[model samples]
Target: MGIKVVKRHGSSFKDKLYLPAIAGGMKTTLKHFIKNLKDVDNLKTMQYPEVQPDDLNERYRGVHRLTKWEDESEKCVACYMCATACPAECIFIEAEERFDEKAEKRPKEFKIDLLECVFCGYCVEACPCDAIRMDTGIFSFTGDKREDFVLDKKALMKNERSKDLDND
Candidate 1:
């Protein structure tokens, strides 16, 4: 037996009219090209670093940041909740017991590697004490070395949104 191929229907009127459809598409393309060529400056493109868009909203997750007080004191209670909740496992924290005339457990070291972070915002959401925050509004983070992206307590606290924990 011989293999066979069959077509039940012949080409339709629309199939025969492909050239006009192609011409119509080209016309639309040309119209856009002419319009863009005439007003190239009006194109929707921004010169980054030189010009940037305003902050989108409070919910915009850009960078990972740990909170501090006005006195440059660490706001994190070192509950390990943020670290546990972090999907990327980018957060590192070490809690220590301290006495402020009253004994309390607080974080001695808190670090977040922004390079490894996915900006999921789970840390901020999981914080029960509102100890951590990502309200710096300074979203852009770049550095040459891998260690540079590891944001420590000092760097995170320096953000404008963070208060001075030490003085407070």
Candidate 2:
């Protein structure tokens, strides 16, 4: 066994002066400025808030939501699969026995701390009942209080289906 050591070369006089780096940066800025000037309409800048970009990706996992069946009942069976799968441990669920014989259990309380969530979509993938999904198409969220970021079952249920998933 042998350890190989390689000699490192020092920067040349021109590189030390950084003139070429500055010139390259200026050239790039000038090229972009001229290109934008030639086609002002092609500028990517949007007048945000009033004019939102229309290029939202269909697969973007924006927000979490609980699915509802045709009768408007929650599809979750309180299996805790999603909570267990969450690497961030942001999902919290309290299971209770269901009155219906067909459904053995239901979530008495379900909450997800959006601030702690990594938005990795593992919860959605772990859901066996297709009860949880992250396709609300609402990537932006703002709040003054920490509690505002905590989404309860009601809030999760209110999210509309993503445009792409709505067709399904």
Candidate 3:
């Protein structure tokens, strides 16, 4: 025969149930609500577009910009360092050899899928020639299809960062 276990229960006697915890939470909410009500003039619940942040870092990795040297030459030898270092793997680059002795190679087709980008700024750190940068401070990205987020050379070059980049 198998052994059986007995169950247990407490007699019905009640103190205040969870009233202190509830009161504490309510107190916190009321404190913040009253403070905001007192300082309605100082509160900035809205005021977008009218006020923005700052600009890019000296080395901010925003939208990629192919760097130009002092001689008006492209700095990128198309070594693919930026693509390899990108954590998001958003950077796609194709290199082509240059006939000119001064300019050895340039990107045949460089594309960055902003959709996949985490904005971690790894690509900017990996560039040997400073060919790519994420200077645009804009953080909002919206798209309906895969193609919409794929930022080509033209879009990256022209896409300007808002002033918010300087905030951080």
Ten residues in a row with the worst lDDT in model 3? Answer: 7-16
Q: Tens digits of per-residue lDDT for model 3 on 76-107?
A: 77888888988888888888988877567887
Q: Could you tell me every candidate's TM-score relative to the true structure?
A: 0.71, 0.82, 0.67
Quick one: ranking by lDDT, best first?
A: 2, 1, 3
Q: Which ten residues in a row have the lowest lDDT in candidate 2?
A: 159-168
Q: How many clashes in each structure?
A: 15, 0, 9
Model 3: residues with Cα > 4 Å off, grouped in runs: 1-22, 44-46, 54-61, 69-74, 141-144, 160-168
User: What global local distance difference test value does model 1 have?
Assistant: 0.76
Whichever of 2 and 3 has more lDDT, that candidate is 2
lDDT digits (tens) for residues 72-152 of candidate 2 = 878999999999999999999999998864489889999999999999999999999999998888878889999999999
Badly placed stretches (over 4 Å) of model 2 are 1-7, 163-165
Off by over 4 Å in 1: 1-33, 101-103, 162-168
True lDDT of residue 155, candidate 2: 95
